[model samples]
Target: MKKLLAGTVAGLAMLAIPAQAQAQDAKGAIQVKLLGTAVLPDGKITEVKTDIVGLPAGTQTEANDNVVPTLAIEYFVSPNFSLETICCMTQHDVDAVSGLTGAELVSDAKLIPATVTAKYHFDLGGAKPYVGAGATYFLWVDVDPGEATLPLGVTKTDLSDEFGFVLQAGFDLPVNDSGLAFSVDAKRYFVGTTASWYAGDTLAIQTEHDLDPWVLSAGVAYRF
Candidate 1:
């Protein structure tokens, strides 16, 4: 009876070792991931007004989908808490649609969003799932109103830089005993900006645009 009890205790001790090791491994770890990201626009350009005859009031805008490379770095503050920053730049073609006539005015712009998130991780053996919330600073650049708007005396288009909110959810699955893992993440940004259209030196129209976008990403991560 003594030997049997000792064997059972040894088995339990072995099980406890791995769990303790996992907790120690998770603390203060740094992870970096390179992901392919899809930027999907879910909001619209609103409050557009024009002085041109036949051009309608309340023009709406839509952005085209874009795929780009993304880099994310995370630092574990604890076994269940982390902070991450994701960086990427995307180019989007914007279209101005008339609410009255269904006509479209096309333009293009580039956006660089710096997003920071605080995440809570759920440990699940070899897999870790996380949810996060944060904010983004959107840098809007290279605004060009395509040729379609040039004939209408449009000379320049300006997009305002703005701050936005972000929500994120993702999971990391370890591929081996090494620090390599597979990661899949999704984020939503709630953002809006003002667009000013100019004809030569004069402002033609000023409109508010909502650029809320959904970002989906998948790739490999390495923990160090």
Candidate 2:
């Protein structure tokens, strides 16, 4: 009876090995991740289109960094290819850097970076690494004029909704037998926006800026 049980256990182990190998190439898998992301952006003015405020000659601006919660979803089309999208909202403040240091230019500017990516993943031992590129649209939710700008008769501030591109790279490490994993991702965005400040019917300031930002994320992922 002992010998018979041993043989049965060996046969089951052999079958499980082949099944596990086949599962690696299986399609129709979905992964969802809850992540914390840090958004680091450069908001330097590229061109001052209309500066009626009599700005300084060496005026420079920068966007403050923000950390926000993000949710990512992915669908596997093949063993090595997948498509992904993320949802998040972030807020920032545009402040003067060089000419008028520490002066607030725009406050409580809310942004939604809508994005999607087509990723190619490579399995390196127990770690899965991926690279992706995709399109993005920057949607401005709400913006407020800063205290410094309010004194300039500024009644409203608006940022242009722009479309751009993004590049992404990340990796995932499995934790256990369950479908849970740890993921880390980094994305670089090539985007820009036109900032406009208005006082009633007059355009007070309009500047073209490079809103290029690096988004770094890390969190837990579950596959289904």
Candidate 3:
């Protein structure tokens, strides 16, 4: 199923297909959405692989939430079936949550979540409710060592990018005859990554983190 979905996305991309609207002509359409998104991540350290700095007992971490602008495009294969993807970049910071409060661990980490999903829509009057599932790749384009790590002689910090799955639910409500609609979407992502801190050439801290995030979006969409 993964291979099939991946191939379908690749084929669609190569064809340069544009999104279509559900309320327009129906068969073939295009839709462009401007969305405001909130990303909430759980950045708890699940296991400590290496910790040369010797973290204090009861130490735990949490990733700060962020809100950003997102663009969404949808291709309607049929009124009941469509493919959607979003474009956005979000930044976050990780800090000690338990024992070492106010201590920064990871700073200014920017991520691009590349995703694609297949959705099944249910039409009810002017509103369409949908459910979807897809794959995502969390690309960490930029990351910095936190201020708290400087005193520990930390020179570099890194987060591993990994593939994950996402479950989605959304609704679109048409306002009038014109191709304009209001959209609300929510996605739950099941993903994790490895975090590493380096002190010059030596590995200082290594841990596994559960980066599961809940992404919520709301916006206006134009259909053509």
Candidate 4:
């Protein structure tokens, strides 16, 4: 009877070891990350007419490269699964290709992206590595577009307010088990804006445009 009891106890203990390891591996935690991206301009619209009734020439496209900042938080549901939310701020400076100096227009917008995904970590007996994919909802807050020079003598340029979708992928590198981690991610944002030019509350031109923004991110996270 004693031998039977000892054998049963040993078997149960052996089974519990794997269970405990899995539980430890699947623990939930929180993480924070930083993001960066270069925002490329999509150009401006202009209206022109000849005095007698012909069209004017020498129209040029506007372009600029701007830096954007972002922040994110992730909630781990398992060792390989988590939900992440990202917030970002973007500002742009506009100029013509011929270096035409005008009012430097700026845009301040906020982005919120939420995603749920599974990650695969490489166990090479070194730094832990992971990758994931998911969807996002980008929201813009308080978009104010004011120009120094109006196109074709227009007073206000209406840059459309955009709320769009995105796709995301990223990885994480762990510094230690205590949750000190570094991460980098890339996402593509799809945007549509309607642009219009005005002359003292008078509408002069109107058009629609697409802004494709690709964002890159890197930041540290502390697991609690």
Tell me the tens digit of each residue's lDDT in model 3 across 1-224. Answer: 99999999999876664443333446346778899999999999899999888899888999999999999999878768889999999999999998789899999999999999999999898788999999999999999999999999999999999999999999999976687899999999999999999999999999999999999999998877
Candidate 1, residues 34-150, lDDT tens digits: the string is 999999985476665454434555556677899999999999887788999988889877765555333334466888998999999999887899999999999986888766667
Per-residue CA lDDT of model 2 for 23-77, tens digit only, reads 8757338999999999999999999999899988889999999999999999998
Give the whole-model CA lDDT for all candidates, comma-separated. 0.83, 0.94, 0.92, 0.56
- Number of clashes found in candidate 1: 0
TM-score of each: 0.83, 0.89, 0.87, 0.68
Task: Write model 4 residue lDDT over 1-224, tens digit each, in one string.
Answer: 99999999999999999999888766646766665655554555343321221112443345455676766777777665666776655555444343344544333333333334444545555555566555544344443444544334645555556566565666667788777777777666665556555667766545554555566666776766
CA lDDT, candidate 4, residue 182: 77
**Who is ahead in lDDT, 1 or 3?**
3
Q: What is the lDDT of residue 172 in candidate 4?
A: 65
Considering lDDT, where higher is better, how would the candidates rank from best to worst? 2, 3, 1, 4
Candidate 3 lDDT for residue 51: 85
Q: What would you estimate as the lDDT of candidate 3?
A: 0.92
lDDT of 4 at 47: 36
lDDT of 2 at 28: 36
Q: Give the TM-score of candidate 3.
A: 0.87
